[model samples]
Target: MPTILVADDDANIRELVCLFLRNDGFDTVEAKDGKEALTVYTSVHIDLVVLDIMMPNMDGWALCKELRKRSPDLPLLMLTARGETWEKVKGFELGTDDYLTKPFDPLELTVRVKSLLKRYKMAFTQTIQFGSITLDRKTYKVLCGANSLVLPLKEFELLYKLSGTPGQVFTREQLIDQIWGMDYAGDDRTIDVHIKRLRERFVGTPDFCIETVRGLGYRLEIMS
Candidate 1:
């Protein structure tokens, strides 16, 4: 199930959003302010974040900026009553993936969340192959020729991201954005950990290498 973080000062707004998300089969964690939101986000694994512009302590923009610094590709949905062009631009500039005005339709919010989840989930699949190893994106199964390799969720996502593009080199930011979704609330350390795990899994496979580009990022080396 997808996890969502809803940050709003109003009790009613938080409840309403939580209800809608729950009905849509999403698990949510709620926060009343930006500080609380950041706390919840850092601790829990959230797929997306719904941030309100006006809030005490941190505010949406500041929090969004912090999130972007850690995970540039993290998915964030900015919520505000302003609805002005500049406010929207600021959110976008701060790395919010989407935006919604206050008093938004519950159905529309549901649809947006569903869409984001679908797009993010597509990054990981149960069936993928990098050289001799084959990954089942759905079942999280990894097969190396006749041998099957076990992978955790993070490892699976990393391999899936790399395998999808074949030889394409993806920056750590790109990988974090693709696999962890936008509102990841995690840092580059998250990407490093997953990459380490993935490399160890394919260590014996001389053909498949997750190449490090120094300052660029990592990529699956495709041998011809």
Candidate 2:
């Protein structure tokens, strides 16, 4: 599960969001204000952060800047009642990845979280590792602790391509072109079948797992 830090002053809002996000299969950490948010952020390997604009002690705009400086590639989402165009432009200028107006739909928030993860992955690159499992992009082998597992041609290439940017959601069409040739006569379910076998061989990795983005595609999420 992807871990998100949710910062808001309103007790009810923070609790409600954590409840809904947990129900959506995401792991969430809560903060009551900007300072607390920063503290939580520095202490954890947070995948995404949600900040409310009008909080006490540092507000979302300032917090956004702080977080951006910490990790230029970190994904930040701002939530506030201010829906004005100027406020949004200001948030974007400060490096927020997405902004949502208050009284926002819980479902929409979840969707935004996934979208930000996808966007951040596109903009960044790093070795994908979780626990003792490492997806070596160059060799197309999963290094599990002291051992290595070599995958089939399709599975190796597919996992290697995804490892190029972990957390990136790849649609079936894109995967087909990357693995089997675009001219290959196959359905999307063919991708699913291969994914099933890949997961079976990917052993000893409870923290690293492939996630099916509902109504979209697949993304490999490595939890810290």
Candidate 3:
């Protein structure tokens, strides 16, 4: 069973979340503050975290940042009373998977959690083979034939996206929107940097070709 950590300062809110998640067949652990959340997370093998932004001892922003440093792929869903766009943006920047403002529907929360888990699978799977390279999605470890290559998260996700569609071309805009979600401001250069890094890591690998179209965008070059 999937375990979820629900951290909210308000007792009623925490109980409500726990009840809803438990009804959905998820095992839940509750925490009254961010500090308790971290402690519970360390003690138990939590599959996902639902964190409220406002709390005593520690805040959700700090917790999210710290957790991402320890486990980059740990799915985080931030709950906040502040519904401002900047707050939501900040949450994403801190590596939060999703954001829900106060007074959110229980069904929406469940749906968001399910979606994050689905993406987490794509990001943390082992032994994703494309061309001749075997990329471990979980640890971002890449292996070409018998040799292991180190690749960063952005580069790995870029390659993973391209590998899913061998002959398809993705514009820089599309890549930015898809990968960064609402985090980036449609910067084409970010896409370029990741693509360059991917090319450098898999330099001589025929299956790791990222071809650029002059008037179009970029695509995974299918090497025959």
| lDDT for each residue of candidate 2 in 77-142, tens digit (9 for 90 to 100) | 899797886676677657676678989998899888888887567545435566787766666677
- What TM-score would candidate 1 get against the native? 0.55
Q: Write the per-residue lDDT of candidate 3 for residues 67-172, one digit (tens) a residue.
A: 8878876889999987886676567667676778989999899888876676676545555675667767777777787888777677777887766545445566
State the C-alpha lDDT per candidate.
Answer: 0.77, 0.80, 0.79
Q: Candidates sorted by TM-score, descending order?
A: 3, 2, 1
| Ordered list by lDDT, greatest first | 2, 3, 1
Cα shift from native, residue 123, model 2 (Å)? 1.9
* Of candidates 2 and 1, the better by lDDT: 2
Question: How well does each candidate superpose onto the true structure, as a TM-score?
Answer: 0.55, 0.56, 0.63
In terms of lDDT, the poorest run of 10 residues in model 3 is 164-173
Cα lDDT for residue 125, model 1? Answer: 48
